[model samples]
Target: GLLGRYTPLDNGTDTVDEVALLELMKKTGYSMMQENGQRKYGPPPGWDGPPPPRGSEVFVGKIPRDMYEDELVPVFEKAGYIYTFRLMMEFSGENRGYAFVMYTKREMAQKAIHMLDNYEIRPGKYIGVCVSLDNCRLFVGSLPKDKNKEEIMEEMKKVTEGVVDVIVYPSATDKNRNRGFAFVEYESHKAAAMARRKLIPGNTLLWGLNIQVDWAEPEKDVDEETMQRVRVLYVRNLMLSTSEETLQEAFSCVRPGSVERVKKLTDYAFVHYRSRQDALDALRLMNGTLIDGALVTVSLAKPAAGRDGGGATWRHGGGGGGDGLFLFQRENGGVEGRRCTTPGPPGLLPAYGAQRVFPLPPGTPLSPSSLQALKPYQMSSYVSLLEHFCYQHSWSPPDYYLFSTPGPKILLIFKVVLVSTQNSYLPDKLCALVEDARELAAQHALWSLGTHTHTHTLGPRYAHTPTLTLWGQGTHTPAPTLELKFVQELSIILFD
Candidate 1:
């Protein structure tokens, strides 16, 4: 009877009648609280009930702005018991066109979604209903570099409600500055959602800069099952000059053969150990330790879900970058105590055996019978020649790109480009079943360089070439056109 007197306008922009709204709230036994631009109604002042269960909340959107709870509640309650109703409002008293309704039981929320989704509330207005994910974190971007945690929290509280905590990542280059963005955690999902709406582009400015806002990507939790298989550690904040050999030597001190492999990226590296215990020991000793005059942070590397079982890419935190470690294990689905011998160059010496195997894509069909490994003589003749030339010329390392073509028979394409000179070369001979793509590609590169009868002077230094590709070859696979360029300047001679 009381709700009948407070009918909303069709245009939905009418100023709210606070006195009538208060009377309706009291009559309906609903408590009310108002914040910056939202009104929450639930848990009546003198009443008590159990809190809404998890998964019992439904998000209601596309509401008619003029509509109020008195008109909206009856329709929502038709499916279940109401625990709380939060209507996003504006200073002008019109509704913000959306609301969240939590039911006492999860089944009621599900039923509400099934029954009222896309239900028409008026002649031309249909409201959308769905499960609320209940995320309580927000990603705040474009923050002033100089702002600290304390300064940011104070500023956020002035414009929004339910300010709880701000999480800022320190810049790798400058400890005093943040990484230009921070994560803000709210006490509840409702508060975070309200802050997101208020902080959206063009709505507000923080520290004289227009900042960006969105829900923070939740970090995946690592479980005991994952920890059981972890033999890798993600190491970050490394110096760009750090080499794989340097890191391998540093990590090997835990025990003989403790460090299986080390992959050094731009400013970080991944260390694979022979056992999980070895990984644990390395992490404890290496984390927060100084290497090459830089403090590195080490953490357990968790395998990303849904990646290939052969090689699962792992990440440290939810975000990518130095924290992410890409690991490729053997196709046999084993990461411990397995070793394969890789022969050196052909024609130069005897085949070397009993050496450790490098990582490869899983289920790859590169068996011993299918392909012959490279010989020692051939490996040294070509690779050593180029290495000597590079050393003599004071040239940077050559860039290589490796990728596989899609098919029943995968084609490995290896492309190498020397940064200094512009000359391109293709391999005259093809080899198959090599364990390391990089080594095989280097042989092909040297063969292509040797076939050239004429010598050209090295040129000026240029920008780094695009990534080069190296592919594994089959016995019957035809050789693709390959280009090798040396762009740097030096006096060079070629002999047939």
Candidate 2:
């Protein structure tokens, strides 16, 4: 006995045991072979043909006003078989007077030249057929202002009846408007050739204007390694007095191999590096540092390349200043240039001792003779009293006022002397005084509580200092740790 294997055919409406039927046919003396003794092999089970290659070139042409694919494809197919046929349609679904015919064979495409070249498809109007390569060379002009990459693809689909890859140049400031042109790529050279033949310049009208087409310039090819190595760093909030030399000197500490170039951009600078790692390292070390009392920031820079081409051009009117772009100038003798006559806080009174003295308050006045009588207390207490007076009045007393006032000023100076006589041995006495003054101001709503420092000490000596503490109304105390403990405390307070 012989074994026969069965196979089933699923034909949508029904399933049939194809192998069993074949076996029965074989048993009935039917031969499973072709007439020439050659075995015929159909397509493999469930195997569809290969996908159309992407990025193939195609040709497009403007058709005669009355001619269409029905009349067009046969003309080409009669000369040579066609791969696909299409007629471009407008948004209104009317013919746009253009069509594409893709040939199955390149030689058949060549044959179309002899048969259809200048051949009349209608009265007094000769049809045009071009090798797909010619079509690819024609540039598309007058692209719809509102069309994007997707919309371009949809419009081109009607011309080629094949996959299209379109790249559009959009305006830098307005994305919805075209930058006047676009580049379209086809999946087949035949399709590109057809496009060129049909889309004749000066002969086709799109949006009521005669459109032009030409090969777009190829994009500049930059090596991946070179691109990866090039980095842009943005440096912002620079001091107005900061010069290019100062910026360079600040970044000079970075590893020699890291930075490639540095250019100032208005209030900020662009720092480039050989690699992202170098840029990142520079950012970590340079951000938040004081440069002329202003904090500097650093980050990765953007490349100056365009979407259509890899070359970068200035987006603004003026080219960046030759290496040292000064976005602003420092005035020398104008109003802004005048020296600040404003005074420092009164707690720093000794710095202003030469200034005229002011009378104390009427409730507790001070005089030269009484100043000696109250000098026994520690210096810290005197500083604290003056700080309290300045905080209460929202004034810088020692530097701004003198013996002109006979009441509040005299009383404040007397209180300062009396407080000095009452305390001694406060280690950070001046800082404590300032802290107490700030707290009193917070309590009275003279100043917001948000200005309070966490550990009330002289601020960092650096030009740029980050927030040192959360603002609050409280007695001053030293923090044992340098970490941001107040931030955590504030978060808990907020949640509660």
Global lDDT of each candidate: 0.60, 0.40
Give per-model TM-scores.
0.39, 0.24
What tens digits encode model 2's per-residue C-alpha lDDT throughout 89-108?
43322334444454554555
User: Distance (Å) between predicted and true CA of 396, model 1?
Assistant: 31
Give candidate 2's TM-score. Answer: 0.24
The digit string of per-residue lDDT tens for model 1 on 191-261 reads 87788779966799887767756556444333344566788887877776778899999988799888877
Q: How far is 372's C-alpha from truth in model 2 (Å)? A: 84
Return the lDDT, model 2, position 376.
31
Report lDDT (Cα) of residue 399, candidate 2: 17
Per-residue error (Å), model 1, residue 321 = 9.9
Give me the displacement of residue 132 in model 1, in angstroms. 7.9
Model 2: CA > 4 A from native: 1-138, 161-163, 220-271, 276-496
